[model samples]
Target: MRGLMSAGLLAMAFTLSGCGAQPESHEAHEAPEHGAAAEDYERGPHRGRMLRDGNFAIEVTIFEDGAEPEFRLYAYRDDKPIAPADVRIALELKRLGGEVDRFAFRPEGDVLRGNGIVREPHSFDVTVTASEGGRRHRWSYASYEGRTTIAAAAAAAGGVRSERAGPATIDERIDMSGRIEITPEGKAEVRAWYPGRVLAMRAQLGDRVAKGQALARVESSHSLQSYTIPAPIGGIIVEKNANVGAMTGDRPLFVVADPAMLHAEFFVYPRDAERIRVGQAVALRSLSGAARLQASVEAILPTADLASQTLLAHVHLPASAAEQFRPGMGVEGSFVVAVQPVPLAVRTRAIQRFRDFEVVYAKSGNSYEVRMLDIGRRTPEWTEILGGLKPGTEYVTDGAFLIRADIEKSGASHDH
Candidate 1:
């Protein structure tokens, strides 16, 4: 497939190089060496191509002020204006992919107007024929814009790659901020069963302990018997407030939290509270974006924060994420509220601003041209194409800016 495309591109380049005026012929003939230089031809007062054949001349122009582009031609003889009805004209445009557009003209006011509108990207090889006074005149030229050709090798080296435009699933998400915390059921506070003196302290802050494991030895003040203080849960000791000879009262002596069981608490303001619900999927990343994972909302606390008046949405994390995530670490989350399937879409990164339109470059062999788009729903990853691009069309997906730069370097004109 690639070899065939390369051969086609080479053939297109060869054909484009032979662009010039040719006499009328019934049989296919080899195009003469390009000698017209018509692309740089003189412009008439209407800013249209001025083609002369001895004493007869005609100016070709595309007028598109308040309407679609349509052909408007002016005729002349002996360098003087001539009646439009006295001359007959026809135009044929051969586009890049061998598509041909034929236009017939009729007198409209002082100029001859074409029957059809000229579509965008305005790049083609044109053949024009005019008849008057028993004589025939023909002209041909190449008028191209917003297009560039790069060799496959150069394109690959420049990171240019293409993909077929097609349907995609877009995930609509709402962003929120949150912090990782230990769930209530995953934390335990250790306090002496009876008023006692701390006879011995075994566990230290940040120590990992097993459930019911001995953490300390305390002597009861009422019975003078020393009792073992065991850990209430299997987790890391986050807080320790006991020491040898320290008297224990109602205060907790140690706080153990199960880091393996963690949840992220995202704040939901009034504007978004109605949209949040348990079981919705969420993508979470650390504030620095160095760690990321997928989880689902496990619960929504009924009460809102006293200061911020924001509700809490909790998403439980897997034990595997504990290595990268820690309690109180700030995280950013994207909650998927909806998923939509679009008939045609492109990667959001592929879309670029060209003139006043958001566009993506469509690929034909090695030739790349602008495709003005009508965009609809968009996410960070994909954008729905409402119009202006055909399904299954190959388009620049990577290195689109490189193609744009090459076209801009040629200074392609929007002239009619």
Candidate 2:
């Protein structure tokens, strides 16, 4: 491109046949020898003294093949390069044009732009300097390009190319990852517990039924006469509170849907619940169908159920698997209790229960050694070991029960 531009300029100067001789005008001079503009201009072609000149405003733009834009100056009649470091910059953008951002030059190759660098390209001006003896020449250019602002700035500095910055990152580590659902779980509606006519159902079943959706109509039965029953949960009603004139029973009249926001609920031990989160990734498996599912905890119910003696965990299913799941299904899963990946872990089945101890039959030196181990956070395929293990230790995962059966048979043979 530089050669092409230089050649074009020389050709145009050759065409001007009748032009009069002037010191600064093209008269009796040969085309500046290759690299003469840069190598000779600084030397005044002889005394080797750098002389300062007027601040000529120049606009620059850059085009990059694989990275951010680079800068080049096309500002002065005698084109000089502009650079980023030469001018002070301030951008009114969240990312673009910041000290560490990327941007595209506005409207030309001498412009700049990039992803981490631009909101939108705007016109900008800058002041630059070139070494001339003991003084400097300075100037500025407006940018409208989108990705390489720095490139343009550099171009305006010296009309020379600058190197590309390091590769940009994809930034895949999400600070948080979780699932969301339109519904929740185990919702009991505060509907009438006893037989009663609708005194007046004030809160409709689907009216975002609160913990207590009440009916206003008075009743004839003593139970009904005693008190009005409010709906227990806040949910869209799946059933009506009616049969207006019929003898209503104690059974739930308003089949208030306890929306099952979670695909499955697990009981997390108190010690485990303390480490669990509302949005931690979990791997769930259906005990019946052997389907593997990935999901997030929708919630950790506020308090443990006294009778059940367990903490309620609501798991929101992956959108991909929701179609095949329903409420009240049995599932087994591991909730990531920690963020950091631990070492020396294997599938939970790699170990077997030996009376009251956790033991793994490890193969070493041509013998099986029953190894006692400490357990940690467990995923469906891996269980982190807090003790008694190391990476690359050969241990059996599946067929453990079969191994035990074989050992028992051998003992019977010995007895025989």
Candidate 3:
């Protein structure tokens, strides 16, 4: 009878267990949903995301409103507001390819602020430390601030070229405004050999003639016979005063100029006149930048312009540049005055403007990092680097503007 009762009790226990098992399995699946909600990130009073360790927390933000990018921190303790003076905070950021930067914060009212500008790219693995009550707590997190990536094939198609930064000879140049005129060597004045009457005029104004070509027939006063007056050089007749019956004397009858060769004249300020010298290389270009010619400082006039107080410089243009230019056309000349050797330099095309800073794209393997540069002297081809870049570092020398466009397209708009 006892065995029969035990079997009946065991069956009753099994039935009760089966009834409870279904709800327990359902609750196990629902627990994960609750845990996910708890793991969601929280923000601080500054509206920046917060990171916490023990009873201390810090909210980091980049503040830029008509100012440089600065790291602003808000501190908390046990989920409550903490006095900035009670704790000391520090930050160490490690960028891609092993660049590291450290910052020490000082208390400012209810928050702590970095002493210097927070150099961009803003993308980095950040480690922050908060010390209070003789105890230190550190929090580490990865930030994807203004990050963009490009494929190698796309970069190649864009004409991108990479080069290592190194020393370069930077030529310091002086800019001067000038105009093209017919050089004295390319001009001629036609005059009669002796007093005579112009029997006939062969060449008129604006007519092209060759050397020793007859310009007019003259009846010589010494002899009744007529003689031909010849052109002194091959050029266009710019001026004519001789008529069919007019008498020619010592006065010039025509002005001829070889418009193919020109001279560029510029004025140097009194302060810069001392540096002016003969034989210095000069580059003359049209105002539109379409036509360019190389010349040299042919002469420096001793006399200065009475009104402008400037000395005159003459640059001789070659005849081959005739088609691209003409007499009386305006031009600008770049005079290379000094050649400076810079310890570190990069191609001028690599530089771009990002916010308030001048930046260059630094390359490492397949990645590019936006690097801010402090520059010194510069030439048309290269620029001297004062800071923010190291020697032997590879950088994008061409197609940097395309990369900048891609970075903008990626919406990598971090605060300045």
Q: What are the Cα lDDT values of the candidates? A: 0.81, 0.42, 0.74
The candidate maximizing TM-score is: 1
Best by lDDT: 1
Candidate 1: what lDDT?
0.81
Candidate RMSDs in Å, in order, are 5.5, 28.0, 17.0
**TM-scores of the models, in the order given:** 0.84, 0.29, 0.73
Order by TM-score, highest first: 1, 3, 2
lDDT score for candidate 2 against the true structure: 0.42
Candidate 1: which stretches are off by over 4 Å? 1-39, 306-308
Report residue 216 deviation for candidate 3 (angstroms): 2.6
Deviation in angstroms for 15 in model 3? 60
lDDT (C-alpha) at residue 212 in model 1: 95
Clashes of 3: 0
**Model 1 — TM-score against the truth?**
0.84
Backbone atom clashes (below 3 Å) for every candidate: 0, 73, 0
Q: Say which prediction, candidate 1 or candidate 2, comes out ahead on lDDT.
A: 1
